[model samples]
Target chain A: MEQFIDVWIFGLGIATLTYAPPLIFAALGGLFSERSGIVNIALEGMMTAGAFFAIYVSVQTGSWVIGLVGAMLAGMALAALHAVATVTFQADQIVSGTAIILIAAGLVNFLNLTLFGAEGSPAELSTPPKPGGVSLLVPLALALVALTAFVVFKTPFGLRLRSVGEHPRAADTVGINVYRMRYIAVIISGALAGLGGAFISFNVSSYTENMVAGNGFIALAALIVGKWKPVPVLFACLLFGFSQGLASRLPFGSPELLNSIPYIITLVALAGFVGKSVAPAAVGKPYVKH
Target chain B: MTRRINAEAILVPFLAVIAAMAVGMVLTYLVTGWDPFAAYGSLIRGAVGSPSAIGATMLRSAPIILTGLSVMVAFRAGLFNIGGNGQAIMGLILAGVVGIKLGSLPGASHWIVALVGAAIAGGLWGALAGFLKVARGAHEVVVTIMLNYIAIRFGEYLLGLGGPLQEKGSSIPASKSFETSAQLPVFWRPDPFTEVHVGVLVALLAAGFAWFLIGRTALGYQIRAVGLQPDAAEYGGMSVTKITVIAMFIAGAFAGLGGAVATLGELERLQKSELAVIQIGFAGIAVSLLGRNTAFGCLFAGLLMGALDSGAVGIQNDNTLPSGVATKLIGVIQGVIVLFVGIDLVFRRLSNRIVGVFGERGGSGMVKS
Candidate 1:
């Protein structure tokens, strides 16, 4: 019984907590952009910018808090570009998103090489403190889930946002500013994704190239799996985190193959095992003001 | 009647390239403090200055052209295939298997068979995504992205320690070298350092094939019809499901051929590290978009991108900038180009005005739905 609690409950629980928050933050970010009638797959790009800026700021300012803010700003910058392209210019969201992804990657890696040189960020830097063997951001992430739920489902702004996403034409008739709401939602989405990226970097206490890997994509999967609801998205992220935790714990199996389990599960979720995921009616369509 | 040129089609892309290059110059100056002129001078010289540089550019262009065609085909069917990397991985693995295991085949048949096997492998991988989309309603973007990670992991396992494909009695995590007969025949040697193979010819053939398939064939018409309006196509007795799957297969096949050509053309064996860092798949996206999602357009765009890449190498060789800066700058330039191309409304108006000034009204470009 003790062994079972030690491994299955305690160990598994810690690992999940460590891994799931990033996905939660990013998935929630996806929720905002998507619910505001934009398909922002550039969540990955925004996260990349956040991840790089977090470490750089942490090193420079010697403050983890400032680092987190820097991360969000970086993400927001990228997201603003996405908004300009997709919302204002009425470009293909996917194409614009792809461009952002490439740009973020190149720009971040360029800055990393030029600033940090070959050795990378210093051996020591200010990272968030772990009060109970987990970072403070973990609880903050949980709080944001509740916060997001309240903001998205229980507010007038939430109603306006949903209206813009679902029926923008009608929403426009009702005096809701569709473009302003979308830009705000997408920018907020960037902030959240940036926080997610910061969490991943802070966990490691340093930055590495491609360190975020495909977690942004995984968070995207979580958004789909969670059906874009705040509570359900939290559960989906936890599920992915649990799988990652379990993969690390298994006594036997190729680590490479084991690492793929989360992705495969995401594929299965997207394949409709969790049920059909229907996007907002007006999502992915650019609204042209006549 | 005199044929009126569609000035927008030619002008917008040309202007976008100029805009992106300008952005690259500003970025280089702001970040590196390097003289943008000297950097660009070195870049151009590296791209087409010498026989060896041109050879290198051609070598790089071949795979990108094929992958570009891969993306182009899928775009015609109204599908976005972001899984070119995954498809290419599937192709390379099968190509590696055929190249390493099949030693008995005589002459060019061995390499030819390898390329065919690669196409089949890549096609099947792509078809899985299409099937999931049609049968299960899973978005291809998410599915294909997941597939890319899965393919990387799978390939890593195959080549990692104690795996089936790992070299026997060696510590290195890579497959055994291919037999001499399995390698592509090199037709040109610009210098002792550069051995140009027939992959360029293969890319050209594939581009021609794509042009014929999308422009001439009955299936091409169906693909275009479905892409334009799936509801109308379905009402007209076309199976959207079947077309999606077939188009994805063709897309995957071209990408797969790209992988095989790159591997057989360049490497002796498949290395484990290369699987994670393969940029050709994503590069295909830029190639397709910049090419305006056409076969010949892909050919020119791929060449341009390849030149930029080889030019980065030139920047490094000339010591014009710090190491690793040039490549990343080129990447930023490519991304900017894609952005400019995506938001081409600004360019369209400019092109129209220019055409008006010339007393020739510009025709509407192929506007993406």
Candidate 2:
């Protein structure tokens, strides 16, 4: 009984805490972008940029907090490009998102190679603080969820944002600056995604190529599964995190197959096993103010 | 009228490519602080300076062309089909299985059977996405992306140590070497090290087939109608659901063939590690966009992309930059190309302005597609 509690309870709990925060940060980021009527598929790329810049900055300045700021800035820069392309130029959101992914992956890895050389980041570097065997980001992520819920549900800014997403033309007539709201939402999403990326790199104490590894997509899935609600998204992320923890601990089955459980669940959820997940009416459609 | 639109189609991608290349040069200068001209010079030499270099470009071009065609087919039916990587994995898995287990088949027939099996497996994988989209109201983009990860995990499991497809008694996370008869037939030897295979012809043939299917068939008309206006097509008595499934199947087949050709042409067996790093699916997106989503355009764009990749190898060999930096730079340029092409409206105006300089009326009579 003691062994079960130690192995299954404590170990799994710690693992879930470690993995779920990044998803929470990123999924919340998606909520912001999508709520403003933009399909931020580039969350993955933004997260990738965040992952790299976090470590690179932390290593350069010897301050993990400054590293996080740099990560957000990098993500915002990419998000700004996404905004310019999708909102200003009226480019297809998915195409622009795909471009951002390619650019983030390429540019980040290029910078990593040029800056770090073949050796990669230095062995000893500053990392996030851990309290009670859990990274501080875990509590921070949960707090953000509450904050997001409040901001989105109770705030006027949130109402305007959702209005723009649901009916931009209607919001436009009512005097909401649709473009500005979208741009701000996308940039905020980037900042949150960057924080998520930083948490991943900080946990590992280094940034490696492909470290972000589809977590952004999983967050997008979480956003859908959570029905675009903060509390439900948190549960969805925790469920995915739990599956990951279980996959790692399972002693017998094919680990590769086990590793695919989260994705399978995501597929099932997206396929409407849990119910219909409808997006904002204006989501994925470029708004043209006549 | 159609001729004029075709001119714009060709010109837009051309301008985008030039603009993207300029951006690449600027990025190269900003990042490396090296002479961009010298870097490009090395890139050009690496891509076409020798027979082997050209062979390398052709070798690289083959798989991306098929994947490009795969994307093009789906795009014509108004589906993104981002699941090319997943479909290709399914193809390669089945192809690998056939190549290893069905060694008793006669010469030429063995390889043919393997390719067919790959196409079927990939098609089924692709059709599943279409089915989900139509039947379950799930978006293809998310479904396909999820499928890519699932396929990767499945492939890893099949080839991982103690897995079903692992080489018997070898302890390597790979399948057994394919029978020589199952390998793609070599047609030319550009150099002792570079063996040009029939896979290049296969890609070309696939491109031709795409052209015929999209341009010369009633089914193609229905697909285009559904893509252009699904409700209109449905009102016109065409089944959007069936066409979508068929289009996805065709797209999957092309990508599957791409995986098999690359595997059978280059590697002797399937490695677990290669499944994760397959860039052909994403590269197909770049190729399709640059090619203007036309079958022949995909062929040319794929070749150009292949050349750029080979040129990166040249950059490495010349030591102009640190090793492995050039490929990443190529990736950035590819991304830029997609960005420029995605916003082709900006490029269209730019192209019209450029044409206006040479005595053609600028934008007065041009129609947006």
Candidate 3:
């Protein structure tokens, strides 16, 4: 009985370490975009782009830090596409995000085909250096999460950003540049999402197709499960990580069934427990300069 | 003025599709470095020139058309049903199980049993989303997406070699070959040219039925009313919650039928395991959007997509382009179409003012968001 409990705890710890960096970073990215009144559903696509670029650049340059930076830039570039569609053209946020996802998928596949040809050669890339037997990225993620939580809740910039989200017109009337705030927020969101992607490539392995594998959506769930608060959101991500870790460790009758534990839990939580978590009133509403 | 606007709305989506195809042609040229004219010619030949190709195209269109309608129905009611893939998989598994268990039953009865089982499974899966939306105020988009993962995982578990539904003698992770008696029969004999089955008629019937339901039925009236304006709908004595649930149920049933058609019409048995890689359900979303969430639109859109897919196989054989490149091209075109459609309403206002060209637009007031 004691051994079982210890194993469970050990699994939870490993999960926290494995899952926290990416989840927190991506959720923080979501916070920036969403809090700024933009519905940023392209986090998944942006992360994927980042993951692809991180590995591509790292393999070319043999520098992990440069790869991470490249990943962030790639993420920003994808976000810029969303900005053009949703902000400039007044496109529907959902449709725009969906387009971005499809484009990202196509681009990745096309790049793979062009670079590796039909056989598709696997390229070796340098992993980010860790110190003191822990992934450096994990501590960096924790720090970023803490920093983001502080900025979102305590700072004046956070106040303005939240105001823009709650009522863009009102913020505009108050002389806040709503568009500028939203653009910056979304770009920042993209960069953070990219960082999460880089962690996967640099810390895990060379980018494989669909390596992000719904992690972006998982972060979105973590946002809802966290009640859109940064601290609670972090905890929620840890919970998901723990569930994932435990599931992986268990010698279940069917591994596939066991693997579905986190998703099923998330579905149940979204359906039955997350009661009417309201978004900012101005979400998905394009700020038209009347 | 309103009538003129409606006419223009109808033209925009069609123009959007043409524009997307044009862009896709350009991208295809860049990617494959092939002669554009030859590639397009091959596409046509593969899709429709040969009898077998045409038959295969029609057969492939069956599920997409139905699932596209499923998505269209839900979208009309202002819900994004991303769970089509999950629902379709569930339906497929349920139908397979029923078909195998009831193998002793007489001929057509087995087909009916399988079809009904699939429909029920899909309906239940879809209702889960509706239930969550109404009961917990959860967004259907998030819930549906999550449900998709669950469904895939569950399906993989059910279809695993040692799992329930696995073929008795099969060494692979797949269900048994459905009894020949249980299989959906081809309306026509295997001609030298094609593999068309009877499911195309069923898909057309489903399209016609969906069109009638949305256009003429009282239930559809409530659904549209709620979709257009929930507050006003409530004031008019319609239950928004009920409409949402019913709409999802119908949507799910359509997707379920799509899955059943795929299994009965094409595979005859569920093959392979690991659910994450299936593209049919997500492809349905693209079809629904490309069709502008309408019955007639879904039919044509489904046919176009099925043709592109079938043609892609031919393109792979004739050219150095990878098999997935063509499908990805279809996705790109679909994405471009949706992007254009979403911005079309805004663009039309600008174009109308700029060009002084006036015509009826079909969906001016219809696109709620």
Candidate 4:
């Protein structure tokens, strides 16, 4: 029994850490964009871009850091297209986001095929980089979340971003350059989302097709369930990560159905059986400044 | 004024298509270093150069049109139903169940019954989200997105290993081949291989029905009113909640029909894994946006998109370009088209101004939808 307890603890701990970084980073990405008045449903697409670039560049450069930078840049570039539509052109944010998802899937896969001749596996990272069995990215992820909380709550930029999201007109009245702020926030969102994707690729040692899977959407759900706050969002991600981490081990009728737990939890949270989600007032609405 | 509006409607989508295709051509050139004109020529040939290709394109349009109409119905009611794909799979699963189980029904009646069964399943799934919006104030967009996953997992449960829906003696998680009676009929085959199925007609008639329903019916007016001014609609004795629920139901039903038609007319049996994360539903969003959420608009847009998809397959056989690049080009074009369509106001202005250059009134092009 003592051995089982230790095994369970070690397994769950590893699984939890494994699953948490991507969700945390992506959620933080979502927080920045939403707090600056953009509905970024393109996180999934951005993650795909990030994952594709991370593996491709890492394989080519033989350096994880270079690959990580490439992934972030790729995500930002995709997000820029979204920003051009939702921010500059003042298009329907949802449509713009949906378009990004489609474009990313097609473009990344096509590039993968063209570049690697196939989705060839990269170097594996099954074991943690540190001897203590901790992924270096996990610590970075936690630090980033804390930094995000500080940036969102205590900084002038945070105040400005929140004000813009809360009331764009009011923010514009205060000479905030609503579009510029939103564009910057959205690009930053893309970069962090890209980092989240980088974590996934780095963890696995190689990127698979659709490797980001629906985790991007899962992070988006965590963002909403966390009430758009930084710390709470981290906890929400960890909770989801825990469920997903232990899903295969759960003695459910079918392991496939058990995989649905994270999604089900998100639904229950959204169902308002608990507390209702209050989005940033100007979310999903394009800012048409005078 | 109406004539101008009509002309503008046609012109804008055409311009968007032209601009998008042009960009697609350039991108293809940049990426694959292939000749853009030849690539497009191959695309057109693949889409409609032969009787078989045209028939294939038409058959593909049936699902796109139905799903486009699905998004159109929801948009009219001020709802963004992102779960068109989810709703479609529900429809497919229900249709499969009815097709397999309803053995007693006559051959002629079997397909109809299956179609209706699919629609109802889809409608119910859709209505659940609408109900949540009214009862719990859960945003439909998020709810629908989340609902998509549930439906997908539920589908996986029903069809995976030891799943209730899996066929006997089959290792794959797929249903048995549908009975002959359940299949949609194919009309005059212009070629030996070409089968022009009844689903194409069903799509057309549905488009016609949607047009009449949205343009002439009291329900459509109420839906539009609720969408444009929910408080005013409520004040005017139209139950905003009821309208929202009904609109979602109808939208879901159309997508259900899309799935049903695809199953009944196209595939011999329902495959579980393919049904999960199917792209047809997301493709519907593009169709709806490009179609301007109008019934006739959906028909043409469906055909155009169907041709592009068909052409994607068609271009591959030509071997002038890498199959990978050719296929990706279709997706790029589709994505660009939707991106352009998302900025509907911009294109409307561009198209209207182009028209104004030819017209005498010097139209300001200031009108908003």
DockQ of 1: 0.71
For model 2, how does the per-residue alpha-carbon lDDT over B7-80 read when each residue is reduced to its tens digit? 56778899888998899899888977878998899999989999999999999999999999999999999999
What value of lDDT does candidate 3 attain over all alpha carbons? Answer: 0.78
Residue range A1-290, candidate 2, lDDT tens digits: 99999999999999899888999999999999999999988888899899999999998999998998999999899998989989988888888888888888889999999989888999888888898889988989999999999999899999998999999999999999999999999899999998888888989999898888788888888898888889999999999888777877878788788768777887788888878788888999999988
Best by DockQ: 2
Better of 1 and 2 by DockQ: 2
- What TM value does the first chain of each candidate achieve? 0.96, 0.98, 0.91, 0.95
Question: What share of the reference contacts survives in each candidate?
Answer: 0.68, 0.67, 0.55, 0.54
Per-model C-alpha lDDT, please? 0.89, 0.90, 0.78, 0.84
Which docking category, incorrect, acceptable, medium or high, applies to candidate 1?
A: medium
Between prediction 1 and prediction 4, which has the larger lDDT? Answer: 1
Name the runs in model 1 displaced over 4 angstroms: A1-8, B1-4, B320-323, B362-369
Per-residue lDDT of candidate 4, residues A1-290 (tens digit): 88788767887888889888899999999999999888888898899888888887877877778888998999899888988899999988889988888888778877776666553654552322644666888998999999999999999999999999999999999888899899989999999999898888777777666778788888998998899999899999998888777875655576557667766777777777778788999998887766
Model 3 lDDT per residue over B1-369, tens place = 123324444566667777777887888777667777787777778788777788878887889998999888888888888788888887887878877776567767877788888988998899889988988877888788778778877887778768776777778888877887667777765465465666788789999999999979998888888788988998999888889999999999888888888887777678654356555666677778777788998998899889877886676667756657666666667667767776776656654553444442333433332
Candidate 4 segments whose C-alpha is farther than 4 A from its true place: A119-134, B1-6, B188-193, B320-325, B361-369
How far is B42's C-alpha from truth in model 3 (Å)?
3.2
Report the C-alpha lDDT of model 4 over B1-369, residue by residue, as the tens digit. Answer: 232246566777788899989988787778677788887888899899998889989998999899999999999999998888888889988988887777747757988888889999988888888888887788888888877877777888888877888888789988888888888889859788778899999999999999999989999999899889999999999999999999999999999899889888888887877765577778899899889889999999999999998887777777543456566667777788889888767887877688777883443434445
| Count of clashes in candidate 3 | 14
